[model samples]
Every structure is written in structure tokens, then in C-alpha cells.
Target: MPLPWDSQHFEISVGQIISPALTNSELENILSYAKEQGYHLIYWATCPDRMIPLPLLQSFSGSLVDRKVTYQRKLSTEFTFGEIKNPSHSFEVIEFPRSQANQQLKTLALIAGAHSRFHDDPCISKEKFAGMYHIWINRSTLHEIADVVFIVKNSANMEDCLGMVTGSVKNGIGKVGLMGVQKKVQGQGIGSLLMKTLHEWLISNGIHTSEVVTQKNNIRACKFYERFGYKLESLQHYYHFWVQL
Candidate 1:
């Protein structure tokens, strides 16, 4: 399952593929084809349960870059919206509108400082990484993939963004697409408040299950989600393969 349209670079989610194994020839052919099709940078994900032989992977000229854990939770019961008071009494959580793309892009740029794994990969520069997220948000707006986006704003000044949360639903399952709190508000409870609100929104929309993924090194994010009842589901190994054009 390669998600080429998700970003400027192509990403093959091997963990999602049920293939027993990718033979040397198959891997070569796939890489060759992707290169022929003008895919300069390619990456893939695999888990312990569906391990790719190290020898087979070593044959490629690419590099292993990141590891992530996927977390999931079932929405069996209704959730009561928890206390999400803004200490300044100036912030409010509101739906993100496509009209505010440019503004949100600025906010996201700041938020992404805490996020360094995928963006910090050798193959991705700061500009390219930001492009990846911009493309994702564009797809979300145009394709309804991530149809739900919420932002915490200062009521006194709507332009003052504190954090953001985004989600998408498909086939009765929901996914937290992205969540970030600005540097200034990281220590505050904004992240937790956003998660609780998103959970409540998912339940109200009849979603039966929801999931999210974060880098293994993101201890704060992992612990935060777990506190909200999201259980560890899978740990995935990530690799990036570069092709010369």
C-alpha cells in the first residue's frame, strides 16, 4: 500500500501489506519501476510481525531512518467532554477552516519544531518536510481525507493559535491525523484537552475505533495518549530509499 498522493514523496506502507515476503527481484522491480516513474525518494514501514529480511533490505542503497508505535482505542461508550478551561480565559477550541490554510501553515511550522523524526530524516530538509505537511493538509481539504481539524485560539485574538488537532474517519474507524501544541503552550493541558474533545467528537460521529501514530522517541505524546486509554498496538520499523534521477 504505497501512499504516493499523501505527500511529495512516495511512501510504501509495508506493514499494511499482507504479502508473505518481498523477494529480491520483486523489491528490485518495484524500486526500478518507481524510479522510472520519477519517484526520487521512497520510504516504507514494517513491523516485527511482518519482518523484512535484513539481508534483503541491506541489498538496497537506502537507509533505515525511523521507528514508530501505533496506538488505538475503541469507542464503545459515549464520552463526557472533560474540563478544558483556558487559564487565560481567552482561548477557545474551534473547527479549522480551509480558508485559514496560510495562517495555520505558520502555526504548524512552529509546532513542528517538537516533531523531528520523519521531518529530520536525511532525505528530507526543513523546507521539504514542511511541503510534505502542506500537501497533506491540501489533500485533507480537497479530498475529505482529514475532514476534521480543530484549533485552539485566543478568543480575544482569533489569530493567536495555541494548538491544533486533526482527524479522519473511514469505514467506521477514525484516525488522529495530526496533533500539535505550540512551544509556548506545550506544558499546559492543551494537548490533553484537544484529545478528549476529539474523542468525544469521534464518538458522536459514530466512529467505533480510533488510532494514532507517533515516533517511539516521542515519550510525552505516547504517554499522553495512553493516559486517554489508547493502547499500544504495533511498533513499526521505517526505511527510506533514495533513487537517483
Candidate 2:
């Protein structure tokens, strides 16, 4: 006598999870839809001799939206820290909210300060300096930290600006900009104090790294950072390129 057909062997095909109530054909369609729609799918190789679907948790960080919208810096830094020899000259560390649009003008002027120092060099003449500063204070500020401006001052106004550091905040990373003390004030302990404050702040806040960049020609700034303890992270030959895409 001929045996009746066994329905348990049938497969479903509608991209839906199968249950004991679902015929085998319906489960086949479900898997087909899942694959076509880019949904992840996995099942255990053995679970009491039966396969069980597993959950999938894919990362969104490397997706197109995340990758296309992010920017990374190519420069390295030499870290520094003060040994704290009595805290003789006291300084105040202040944090400002960069939320106010008007504050952006101050930010631009600060960038101008750095650019002005290099204006005479042919490699970064006045126009080039200004353009570079503009790009830094504008687009790049959105990447790292949220524009924290720290300054040291004393008798004789900001002329004794001692030192300054600025950068944007992102995901709690510290990417500092060395608006290094101008040509006049070189070894007045300003750089050390600034780095010390930065170190303390970064450590307290659980920031992972404090990175700053200085031109290879600027031996003074490079040495200054080295005295603090920042190691040479990397050597990169960077060129700025623009495209209207």
C-alpha cells in the first residue's frame, strides 16, 4: 500500500519565522525574503538535534552614513607634563561653552593669531595662512573636541598669553591645537603650565589621548611638547585637498 505524504518535511518561503504550525514551504519563502532585504540570519548547528535561529547584532559605525560624515586628522604629538615644583605662579583654568554663535568670531580671531605667525613664510604666506586657519577653525573644529580655549596670563596683558590650546570635542577625544606662544615669549613656563592643566583636565575627564600637531620646521614647539611627555605618535605628510562634491 502507498504511504501518505509527510507534511513536516515541507518548506515555507515568505521571509517569516517558522513555527511548528508553519509548513516547510512557508519557511523557505521567509528565508528568501530575509536574504534579499539584507537582514542577517543565523541558526545553531545543533540544539538538541534541532536548529535554532540566532540573533544578529551588526555594527552601524562602519556604515556609509557614519563613514562618509567623519573626518580624521593625520598629525602626531609629543606629550608633556609639569613636575609640579611648588605651583609658584597660580593660574585659572576656565571652560567655556562654544554654543553661542557670537563666540565663533573669537574662535576665528584666535585662529588668525596662529596664522599671522606664519604669514611671512612662502610655504604659508598671508593668504594661504588665512585659508588654512579658516579651514581649521571652521570645518575641522567639528571633529574632535567642542572648542575648549585655555589661556594663561599675568602682568602685561595677554601679551603674557603664556599659552593657549584649542580644539573641538567628539566622543570624548582630546585633539589639541598648539597656538604656541608667539616668537617673543619662548621659555617663560607658559607652555608647561598649559600642558599641566590640560593633562589634569584630560585625566580627570577620562579622555584617552591629547594630540597636537606642530610643523617639522617649528623645532621650538616640537621640543616644548616633548618636554611634557607626549611621545611621537606618527610622522605624516599631510596635504589639504578640496572638492565640490
Candidate 3:
């Protein structure tokens, strides 16, 4: 028997249908159907949040699922803001207000990057991915905006000590996702510079607060977000499992 929100808790196998344009009613219908079939946990698409199918929750039938706080961070009503005034690195790229078309290209690129081979399906399929990529690229110019950043390179080459950080803006708040540097890139202030740039962009957009959800064991990431002015808001638990058509 599948858990209440099975599709969200585990990786989807072949034959499992995924949707990018599913409506609230449609998702509820599928979730309801999955519940009746003994499946638990489901994938959800949050569009303004980048349509990334982020496994952000463990949903279930009202009969079986309980919303529990596993990990969370709250935004202040009067959150302090910061801005990036100087740029010392040539690779620091930032985009603004998160254009739908431009973000589509970014998600596609991240899907194809060195780190996305395994989790690509959970995000989007290759065909749909390629299609979205072309659409966004055609509509998005290389205009340097003030709110987005790019750490892109020709390849994923890195020294043993360099670290990297990733983030996203949700409903105007900037949430830092993950950050680590390779040994070579560590201690050179790359991570801080990136952080500064992101915060600057946030302030410029009148976005002062930030939020993100991380697993319980990801202590490093949690601490990093705090250091960047994010306070713990709540804990969240997400379930995973597969569902038969």
C-alpha cells in the first residue's frame, strides 16, 4: 500500500504521468484519486515559485494527511534589507523581478547542469524541458537585470575548496537554497559576494524577508540561511511514493 502522499515521497517510475500545467482542481482530483487507490504523497507545481515541482509538502487525503511543521523560517514584518554596491567578480550575473520566460531558461539549464542528471524527472521531462527552453530563450534576451544572478560557466570545473550558493525569490522574498564552495573557491569571499549580490537585489525589489525549506539533516544549509538573516519559521515534512495510473 502506498503512503498517503506516495508520489511526492518517492521517485516516480515509468508510466507515472507528470504535469506542468495542472490546475488546482486537476491536482486535487489526481490527489483524491491517488488517495482512494492507497497512494500517498504527491508532487505539486507552484508556478510563481518557478514551476519547479518542488517537493515542498507531504499532502494526503483530508482523511489521512495532517499538515505538520518540520522545518520553517519566517519573514519579519519590518525585515532589514541590504544592497550590493560593488562587484569584484566578473562571473556574478543578476536578473530582475524574475521574468517568466528568462526563469524558464534558467530552470532548463539547471536541469541540464552537472548536478541534475538524476533528479531531472522529478523536475521536468526532457521533451517538455527542451520545449520550454526554446520558448524562454526566444523571448528572453541577455539583458542584465538587477534581481537575478548567474554563476554559469562552460563546464562544472572547480577546485577542491570552492563553494557555491543558490537561491530563489518567492512572492518577493529571497530565499537562499544551498551554498557550498570548492576548496579553491573557499575563503576568497565568493560565497559572501554572491550572498551580498542576492541581498542587494532583494532590497532593490522591496523584498526584505527570505524563506526556504530544508531537510532535517541539512544542518549546514540551515545555518547558512540564518547567517544571511533568515530566521527559523517552521519545520516541514514531505512524504514520497509512487502511484499507478
Candidate lDDT values, in order: 0.67, 0.42, 0.42
Which one wins by TM-score: 2 or 3?
2
How do all the candidates rank in terms of TM-score, highest first? 1, 2, 3
Residue 51 in model 2: shift from native, Å? 58
How much does candidate 2 score in TM-score? Answer: 0.46
lDDT tens readout by residue for model 3, 1-245:
23332233233322222654555466556666765755433443222222223331224322211122223344444544344223343344333233444433444333323232222344345655455434433333332222243342212332111233355566766765433344434444555555666666566677766555544344554565576665556543222223332
Q: Which candidate is the best by lDDT?
A: 1
Error of 3 at 21 (Å): 26
| Candidate 2 lDDT | 0.42
Best-matching candidate per TM-score: 1
Question: What local lDDT score does residue 19 receive in model 3, on the 0 to 100 scale?
Answer: 58
Q: Candidate 1 at 125: error in angstroms? A: 2.5
Tens digits of per-residue lDDT, candidate 1, 5-37, equal 544243422112234256657766776776676
Q: How much does each candidate deviate from the true structure in C-alpha RMSD? A: 4.4, 19.6, 11.1
Backbone clashes for every candidate come to 0, 36, 43
